[model samples]
Target: MDISTDVWGQLALEASQVYLTEGGQVRSPFASTTIEKLPDKVLLNIFSYLTHREICRMATVCRRWRMVAYDTKLWTHVSLRPEISGLHVSSLESLLALISIRFGPSLRYIELPIELITHTVLHELAAKCPNLTHMLLDFSTAMQLHDFSEMQAFPTKLRYLCICLSEVIFMEGFMRKIYNFINGLEILHLIGTYEKVEEEEEEIYEVINVHKLKSATPNLRVINLYGINFVDDSHIDAFSSNCIQLECLAVNFCNKVTGSTMKTLFQRSRRLTCLLMNGCSLRSDYVMQVEWEKSSVQELDLTATDLSTECLIDMLTRIPNLRFLSAGQINGFNDSVLKAWVEAGTARNLVALDVDSSDNLSDEALHRFLSRHGSQLHGLVLGGMPHITDQLWQSVLQLLNNANDGRYYEIVKANFERADRTTVVRTSTNCRVSNYYLLSNYNDLIFN
Candidate 1:
């Protein structure tokens, strides 16, 4: 895909005094009229590209500018985060108050830190922004409040949620209420509650029923959970029964989820296209014995998980439509796997790969893998293989060079070419790390 013009438009507006450059006409190098003389539509277009902080700063310029800056389209998608460490609560309250008045009713997507999940603020949000769809909470801060009965009070149309709460909080009627109320929720991202509770509370902490959560979100297509430990056999069964439309299931560091649950998910969710499991102790037998479904999984990520060689090959063998594969350090994920992949002709169809930090993989194996698969690859990550030399990196570069030939890939190719020139040799790794991948802008495509 082309580097979106929207992204370029934002960057240009931020750094340059831009104009409509759609024609061959070239105007004077300087402007005769001030920004105040610009039309409202033009000003709105510029304001739409700015972030909340920049808009706030721009609003302080002049009354005419401030009036123009308040366009509803410009404030629809609001993203806020802490600017500095140890911020005072009063500053946050003041900011929220300002946002309520300034952005009122037009908001669609809001991403904020966990510190801002206040009841009053959420209630205000629910009242004002009824059309909100996505809300992401950065889980760096410990959430102090519970009672997200307030979430029902946040936004009725809120379908995408990313929150990291303690398991105790999940048990205490937050998720159940959310699932019950927000039936339209398609994406529920739980950023694993890995933070330890007080020593006293850990002893008494009890597990809650996750089946209720599954029952509540029947329409869910994506459930990405991190550091979660509550998912079990019952939860899996509930999901299998209820969430048939689910396409993406990502569980990272969730030790409680067994391989049997995974197999059930694979068998049941017919539309399931992506399976991402990281740091889970999934048994090889249950994982390898997955039965077929209508929607063949196209993306598989086993990074940082305990996957053996036999299980890995079996999964690849069974899942025929896989175009993306991300794996971490697995023993015997060297020439043997590469040979099997190439021989099976599975290597030719792959679109992306992220096999970082393999201790045993040689340059010859990667060469064969890439020669077979490189034509189709849009993204690749081979960082930390000890055997790959400088000459081998060049060979790998030559192998995927054809990926640069197309209108959609021009900007990507340019960026890659620029990186090749601007690269400073790093002695630590013995090669510029950027050599491992093209289209750095497409990192998200590698796993999703």
Candidate 2:
């Protein structure tokens, strides 16, 4: 009595149905009636991944989710969208009312586009979000005609602040208002918002002392001035004296800053860790040779500065602890100079080296350096280096293949390197990475 395959399958299905009927009444609840038992902790972790807008939408899902979302910890990050409805209203009262109702006391961090943040709303947020530690306010246009004195009355808990006050008129009292308040600041980024049109030189100079940040935020550790036009070096001197603990200093498009003044200011801050001078027309041969505290500086970014190999050697030798070096457009190094740096192992401890568009580097020089240091290198951002032709990538693969004989090495190459390397690789000409991590990796590239 052998059963056919079809007959056996039918019998098994029938048996399963009979067993289900006899054992459990075979009643399937509606799909909506059943509640899935997902762990609350897992849900919370998922919620953390959502953006502020996404979180706001999720809050309206159900009572339980809404209550959970209302948790103060979850609202610590608030990203205000400029395109959101009811944001463009010029009236402060209506805007405040909407914000207060939608978001309670849970706001800790707020990022607003310059156009959307009304002066009154900014003051109201300052008063409401006492626990605020980070605030990024981008105002790409002229400062509105409103009083910011109310900001002084708000909490001074901000530690990280990035404000683009370019073109904004700062009255005489503005400096006092900021100095009296925002004393707890540690990181300050004051970028001047300048338009292409030429304005009165006096007005440009007038904007300089508008908000004397050095006097206000004495505890500042980092200060970056972008699009800032200063007639003299007095502001830098003031900052050097006041922000004595400064670690990172960036001066971009400050054509008025003399090389001597910059070098002198660099000597003032003992804790200066990173210095960036981009788009400056300093043609001095000795600018790069200026000595700095080697162990203190971990990062140096000199993009679009007119520097030659002579300057490069000066910088490399002086800053021994430099792990990251972005010498963008600093041409003039030939194979000999590169060979010298490689032989001296100046970049042995570096993590990232971005010498893009530099005319000095040659294919042979790059090949020799990567061949020696590629094993320890994690990130290599050498774009626009004329030497990085197809032949150079072949050299890279050959070099890595030679190094991978039982030993371990991790290397991430950018657009310059070929994709066939056996080592763990990430390639791009403009490799996007965090500023801190880039510095750290470069430090490792040099030191490791």
User: Residue 422 error for model 1, in Å?
Assistant: 7.5
lDDT of 1 at 319: 64
The local lDDT score (0 to 100) that residue 143 gets in candidate 1 is 37
| Candidate 1 backbone collisions, by pair | 192-226
Candidate 1, residues 189-213, lDDT tens digits: the string is: 7665554444553432333455667
Instruction: Please name the candidate that would achieve the greatest TM-score relative to the true structure.
Output: 1
Model 2 misplaced stretches (Cα beyond 4 Å): 1-44, 60-65, 83-91, 98-105, 113-123, 149-152, 194-211, 229-233, 285-289, 293-295, 397-436, 440-448
Tell me how far the alpha carbon of residue 196 in candidate 2 is from the true structure, in angstroms, after superposition: 8.4
Quote model 2's TM-score: 0.75
TM-score of each predicted structure versus truth: 0.76, 0.75
What would the TM-score be for candidate 1 when compared with the true structure? 0.76
Per-candidate RMSD, Å: 8.0, 8.3
